[model samples]
Target: MNGPSLAIRQRSLGDLTAEFPLFPPLTRGCPKSSTDEIAYPLEVGYDYARVDPGLFDQTPGTDIARWSPLLPPLAAPTLGEGGTPLVEFEGIHFKDESRNPTWSHKDRLNRVTVSAALAAGAPGVVVASSGNHGASAAAYAARAGLRAIVLTSADSPPAVQAFARAYGARVVSVPAEARWPLLREVVDRLGYHPVSNQTVTHTGHPFGPEGYKTIAYELFLQLGQAPAAVFTPTGYAELLYGVWKGFVELKLLGLTGTTPRMFACEPAADGPHARALATGAPAAIVETFPSAAYGIAGPVGGHRGVLAVRDSGGEAVLVTDEEMRLAQRDLAGQGLWQELSGAAGVAGYRKLRREFGGPVVCVGTSSGFKDLGVGAQTYPVLEHPTLDDLRA
Candidate 1:
């Protein structure tokens, strides 16, 4: 069956109009050839036949026009996810994902994840996330008319819980150690499509990266040229892989002549990916000590972290919680509110500011609400309803 016709929408960033890349059909070796089955290069167990890469990209236009085509036909109720602002700061451009539908970059991944579920004939989708990814999956699944089951850390923010519940997803609270296994059971027993990291090597769903490639496609159109570099906050390094893959594909398609250097900013509390990159190992597993940037805190499962750093000519830099916190506060002063994980890109840039010579883009991965419950909380309460008392 021919899939639904994709909407080719144009987005206007200032005076420049760019089209989102058309979604190409899935084929062996990432080509649209006469292959009977979709073959992926990921070294893991994946039913490649169930995924279609076409739902990932569309011609860029306004946020509506660009993402409208990326959504399913008869899909309605848009909340403005895709066209996040590409903010410029100190010769660096940043994709402020604080503006995404649920205030995180996970929206991009879910847009395609839900589409894949539809193509695969799955009844629902499941993912385990501390914050953004589960919330985004829940939102998109609701839009796709599919059920969503989110297995998340019980310690996650109330905002994240509210968002998932708001979308009608069944939120299963579990200890962090039990999340992945329970998610696996749900996927196996109920046949829900799993969107979380599954491999010991960090290789996520074969089709999920297709959604992330749109970031590079957007960068190319928005700047009218590729920047000198693109930086991302790294947890499992999925976003890093997605952006690099997109640029590599673009270069292959003859749409771009040069690829930008990619960099990953990782929290020092769990810098396994950085350690792996530094040691030339297949993958690095660190004894993680959690920090304020809970979004990017975890033991990286596989070697994709090494792969992302090596392939993109990227270096992984470690940022302390204090550094990320300062970066968060600085960004908020600019009217860009982001979570600690979301601000890691800026932290990376600040660390290498002396070395960076030209245009750079750092991805601010999510809104600050995801981390509001991370530490001590205090709020002043008004004892009396008086304007003068409030002002005082």
Candidate 2:
């Protein structure tokens, strides 16, 4: 049986025109694109022609290992990362990634990134993240028996901070602009592996996004076919691009006849991915404002996202904080407690207000517990009263 990696070489996302050896993992952007001042990430190429179609016959089990042929070299143990459910709430289908091991879709990405760490014989892994990304990386690193370090913004959710620390990561809070530089130092001076971006733009670990492709494979199995369109919360757009790439691989394997229009949902305060898509640039950098949906809020945009939207003929949708609040409440009423940023997909769909020819899927990126103010709300409780109190 073909094991967890069929990856042969790394290909530049700039034009899918350049290739490099898969070893010495490219955590930063491709050299060609980096010289151009735009960080175009690399995608791991696989021998897809040799893949067995029977692999897709069954659902992925505890982790993403079931789709090993399409993934990069995974050297870590499974922590029950994949196998999330697709639940239909109200009118749209939600992929429900909060069910993942770390309670966020980022587990899928870190599963492979951490494997890259282990494969490289690194002592540990380091990342600069304020929320879900940090927490997921810590959990996966712990599972892989690697030391983890998480650099977060000062205002990162306390619950998330505790979550990462509980996983034995050395968690630190720094100024928003200081994380990446510190992380590079940790990688260079300390010789720890870096799982997050260390570029002018958001070019993350090449192998990690390959983990996200499993979502598309799982969705295809769940829906029995590809949905018409998929709306995903977008920050760096790695999740969006990875999901689109999964479907692209499926098509390349001669499985799916059609591909879904990939929608990139961003915070209205700072829609870098949306702006980049509209402007037709390879990537963009935009000024940001405060938004509660911080998980999907970013200043610099990555070319991977622009490629996903443009390639899929999909449009980027921007939603406001108020809109996300409504969407979050809506999902809560229906028994899914997603983070504010997690609800951006549904918010984007509603903002579009356009029905598709077939089913549309919305991705819920993380659990409500990962929100910036998870424990802040105070709900009034009734004192012991009687039937009258109940009636009132």
Candidate 3:
């Protein structure tokens, strides 16, 4: 769908300006102070408070004393990511993100990041993505009237390439290892804003995950309480971190009594988060291998993934390719045809269903088109066999 679409039992986060719990405060990782920095002239008409980290993070105990411009309140036509379907299945709930503009949950991050780019007066945006993120960035940039450059793997799925081009992004194909440095140069040399990430490590942009907070907010509003557990398919683990942080902030603000246990579902070929949780370390020292679920084939979780798992009383689980394929079939039975990685959450729920009591949400991250290259296929030639010819 070209426009926004959400298929949930209708509900809303009414009066986004109304008093809710303050965002939970967390330590800001900014530098001590600016030294040897010359003052530059400021631009007018843009809200001066837009650049403050608090505008995005909104930590607890924050005092909004000044007239800070908030994100335009969540309204209709959300591009199908945040207000996804919260359907019931044998008492378990599913948050289906396939209905988004780009057919993935990445739309949430790109929406928030694109807004930040526009607010900051950026000329355009650049990103390095295998699929969903690039399409999402491109779509949002088109909406915002900014140029978008997508540095993607040469081997990206054709459907994804078509999606990127359809949204007006300049698609640049490159090797996996070569893409990052090129993206950095694009930002430092070309002045195009880096929306994906630029830190030496996998520290993504400050405002990117802010978009993910809406998922948790929707969960509470939809169910009228926190779930007993929540599971997500993991790659960089940004969504996992966002959901956990959102709930923690909610608890701090007295919006919820407690946070649910978050879980990461990884493809067994490269179960980095699972390994990291097993080792009890902040970082997982491993390498990713190619798999059917290309979206979740990362070597390890990003900077904040481990912390999210630890803080939310969560653990990571791995599903084999065969199991994931079976999950795809199972979800199809539920009338949800998702990508291979999209089935990871359902696979996790199937494994751990007996342990949980209250409502559980399994996040379906993307549409099946994202991984159309990997799967079983069969074809038959025209035989023209009539009624009784094949019955014997």
lDDT of each: 0.70, 0.90, 0.67
Kindly list the per-residue Cα lDDT of model 1 for residues 241-261, writing each as its tens digit.
Answer: 778876776676566788878
Q: Candidate 1, which ten residues in sequence have the lowest lDDT sum?
A: 25-34
The residue pairs that clash in candidate 3, if any, are 23-59, 23-60, 24-60, 25-60
Candidate 3: where is the Cα deviation over 4 Å?
Answer: 1-81, 374-378, 381-392
Q: Write the per-residue lDDT of candidate 2 for residues 1-392, one digit (tens) a residue.
A: 24656789999988567899998888887987576568889989988878888888896566888787888777888889888888897777999999999999999999999998998999999999999999999999999899999999888889999999999999999998899889999999998999999998888898878999999999999999999999999999999999999999989998999999999999989888878878888888899998999898878889889999999999989899999999999999988999999999999999987878888999999999988876989987887868998897
- Segments in model 1 whose C-alpha atoms lie over 4 Å from true places: 1-79, 374-376, 381-392
RMSD of 2: 1.4
Question: Please, what is the TM-score per model?
Answer: 0.80, 0.97, 0.78
The best candidate in terms of lDDT: 2
Query: Which 10-residue window in model 3 sums to the lowest lDDT?
Result: 38-47
* Candidate 2 local lDDT, residue 25: 83
Runs of candidate 2 with Cα error greater than 4 angstroms are 1-4, 379-383
Model 2: lDDT of residue 232: 97
